[model samples]
Target: MKIQNAIEAKLSEAFDVRILQVENESHKHGVPPNSETHFKVTLVSPDFEGQMKVRRHQSIYKVLAEELAGEVHALAMHLYTPAEWDAKGQAAPESPNCMGGSKKDPAMNAQGDH
Candidate 1:
């Protein structure tokens, strides 16, 4: 949980955070058990009020650059301002199931077996 802790700490310090959830989703991916490679973050802050979606994402990327450069392989971010969160009924969209790695079903492969 070191990486997750770091992410939470950094983001909280960088923004006026209202609600923050840092989920470790590595188990849902192809990585080994207990890995810290995949994550989903739900961040609601007044700081995002004037920022575009890309800008919000870029800000987070900058804050978590160390984690991203190391073990974190994927980050799914749900960012919202207070008004947006209220409009969305205080919910972030669920992350889709991971489709990469050897765990992919053969039938779902884009190319059929040779």
Candidate 2:
């Protein structure tokens, strides 16, 4: 099975998930071609009903220990319980570009005038 599928399966078994979206975001990062090293996961599950954000993330990390150690280099997670997801209209906001020119470093552009 593919890495993303493996991750989804593991999470599904560990939680009573209502929604799950595992996106391969390696292409957006500054990595070698065909690198399946990074990902973003958006999951809404009943298991997270009364959990804090940190706890929710910890639970997911615990379930994905093997993938975290072996295949995945980086993971950006947006986890929510069904109620929380519904409160926000069940839509996840778009992620802004991280590696490209979207973020400008002041130190890098030391010359004040652009």
Candidate 3:
């Protein structure tokens, strides 16, 4: 099974999710082509209600421990409760590309010349 599908299955089993989108963002990173090491996830569930941001992230990390340790190198998560998602008009922001490391252009560097 694809990593995204696996993650979705796990989340669905663990939470009463109203919305879930698992995006394979490895292509936008500075990794080898077709790498599945990076992902962006937007999840809306009552399980997240009243939870702090760190707590929400921790919950997801705990659920995805194996994937984080093995297949996934990085994950950008946008987690919200159903009410929170409704208040925000149900629009999840897009994750920007990972522009760190030698892949970033020198001109965009804040420290000026390396």
Best by lDDT: 1
Model 1 Cα shift for residue 69 (angstroms): 0.7
Residue 62, model 2: lDDT of 97
What TM-score should be assigned to candidate 3? 0.86
lDDT of 2: 0.81
Runs in model 1 deviating more than 4 A are 105-114
- Write model 2 residue lDDT over 1-114, tens digit each, in one string: 388889999988888889999888876755556767788999998888878889999998999999999979888899998888999999887765655422265553343211
lDDT for each residue of candidate 1 in 1-114, tens digit (9 for 90 to 100): 988999999999999999999999988776666888899999999999889999999999999999999988899999999999999999999998876744566653334211
Output the worst ten-in-a-row residue range by lDDT, candidate 3: 105-114
Question: Which of candidates 1 and 2 is the stronger one according to TM-score?
Answer: 1
Pairwise lDDT winner, candidates 1 and 3: 1
RMSD of candidate 1 to true structure, Å: 4.4
C-alpha TM-scores of all predictions = 0.89, 0.81, 0.86
Q: Rate residue 68 of model 3 by lDDT.
A: 93
RMSD of each: 4.4, 5.8, 4.8
